[model samples]
Target: MTIEQVWAQYRQSLKAFLHTKVASPNDVDDLLQDVLLKTHLAIENLHKPTSVKAWLFQIAHNTVIDYYRKNGIHSNAQQEITWYNEAERNIKKELAQCIKPFIQQLPEQSAYLLEVIELEGKSQKQLADEMGLSYSTLKSQVQKARKELHGVFNACCQYDIDKHGNLIEYHQQATKGKCSPNHMDCTPGVRKKSDDKYAHCSKG
Candidate 1:
């Protein structure tokens, strides 16, 4: 769809769609900007104009997922907006809630490394130079750190992947443990929580 049609037709619907996923009006407003930028960047790639509605909603849905990925579903991100119905306990929230704690489970420098590269939008080579490490060594460290984090998360949860290999849902299999999905309360992300220090950990 053209930018004109987006403004005339899809923008309000996209906002409404976002409201259903986001709990706070302020959060929803911020995500609207994110959705618009993503939509603007990707809109030209869409070939079928008739499918614009579904495409727009998918963008909004993925934007919500990214929001949760960036900011775990902790008290800070939660809000009581009467108009918004609590939609099915948000699989994304349940899935992302433990990410901060899991990252903490890693070594201190590992946590810092992931935060810089993944959350701060830093390139691995750039981080390597900044830290006075060789590029190849830094790349290997990044890969190893990611693997270690993945192994830790895998021990605590089992994901339900669809036929297309897309994650449809996930289940918390761990009881009382450090990596347990319900074990931590955190304000994660590089956005609103940036001022708190050591911004949290996710990318697109």
Candidate 2:
């Protein structure tokens, strides 16, 4: 079959597979285009036309891996800290607001841990003590929670950071309602009173 014909048959299935792995509809569209482009360019190299379905999916799978790999590099590059001006601080706060919903969507224990440690500005050691857990165990849990939280955020938006590790920009994809706050569980009382302003924050 021709490339166009093959793509027509498999595009919907590929997109469905991508949606499960990708949190953003925009990214899924972009990745589908990437798969199409690669398939078109590499089709000449395929010796077996009967294997086109497997070949197309292999390209798609690798494309997803490459997407995360590039983002992972950017994430690591943002480890360094730098001073922020007023504009940068405002942007950071805005990004923080967008993040709150994703944190709330985590498992109850993880959500609670992030809400207390992050939004409430409580120290991990203090939380460990309050929860009657050893410092090492609490630390490990916190790391896992943070990692899961990062995954949720990464799937929703693409972040841009400067050389000094400052967040400069972000692009939200077309995945609406995925990050909406569960207001019943995400009430202001769940956070410290000092953090009330950040409560009920939406992706808007």
Candidate 3:
């Protein structure tokens, strides 16, 4: 069946599914559009026509999660926590896997700086002392390295962040843009170090 025919057959069921997750009619409509877009872009990858229903529902599920993540609305903490445990672990893995490759793509110095500061979890002051560079110089290099890493991620995917600045979802970009990097800089605000692993940085 054609894409339009497939959509027509499942649109009502999809709408009903979305309604169960989203309370706002307008938000549901918006999310349905997002699912439609993702479906259109990815349908050609569907190998089995018989699997269309499952595939469509998967897209709907992810779109709903993206919506809640973007809105920072966790209506069900237990459900959200379960979802987060699985999803966030995958995200961190993806981020870690991409790090070395992208960092190697940077200038040698910038690359080394990032490898030590970010991957090794070294303090900036210690790095500065070891390298015999002024703290200001080390800070500048760290920032530049971070920006370059951010560009690498941006080139790969466009991330969606919530109001509280937590990463919710990431959609791969169709094309590469100039290496303009943006990092997730989180501050520790009265949170213990153990509780604030992301206090320094978060790339999602």
Of the candidates shown, which would achieve the greatest lDDT relative to the real structure? 3
lDDT of 3 by residue, 28-78 (tens): 887775565455435545556776776677667766764564344665633
RMSD of each: 17.0, 19.0, 16.2
Score candidate 2 by lDDT. Answer: 0.55
In model 1, which regions exceed 4 Å deviation? 1-98, 166-169, 176-182, 185-204
> Which pairs, if any, clash in model 2?
none
Better of 1 and 3 by lDDT: 3
lDDT per residue (tens digit) for residues 104-197 in model 1: 6788788787767654546676788899998888878877886777676656544453543222333444333234343541212112211322
For model 3, how big is the CA root-mean-square deviation?
Answer: 16.2
Q: Pick the candidate with the highest TM-score.
A: 1
Q: Flag regions of model 3 displaced more than 4 Å.
A: 75-204
Clashing pairs in 1: none
Please report, in order, the local distance difference test score of every candidate based on alpha carbons.
0.53, 0.55, 0.57
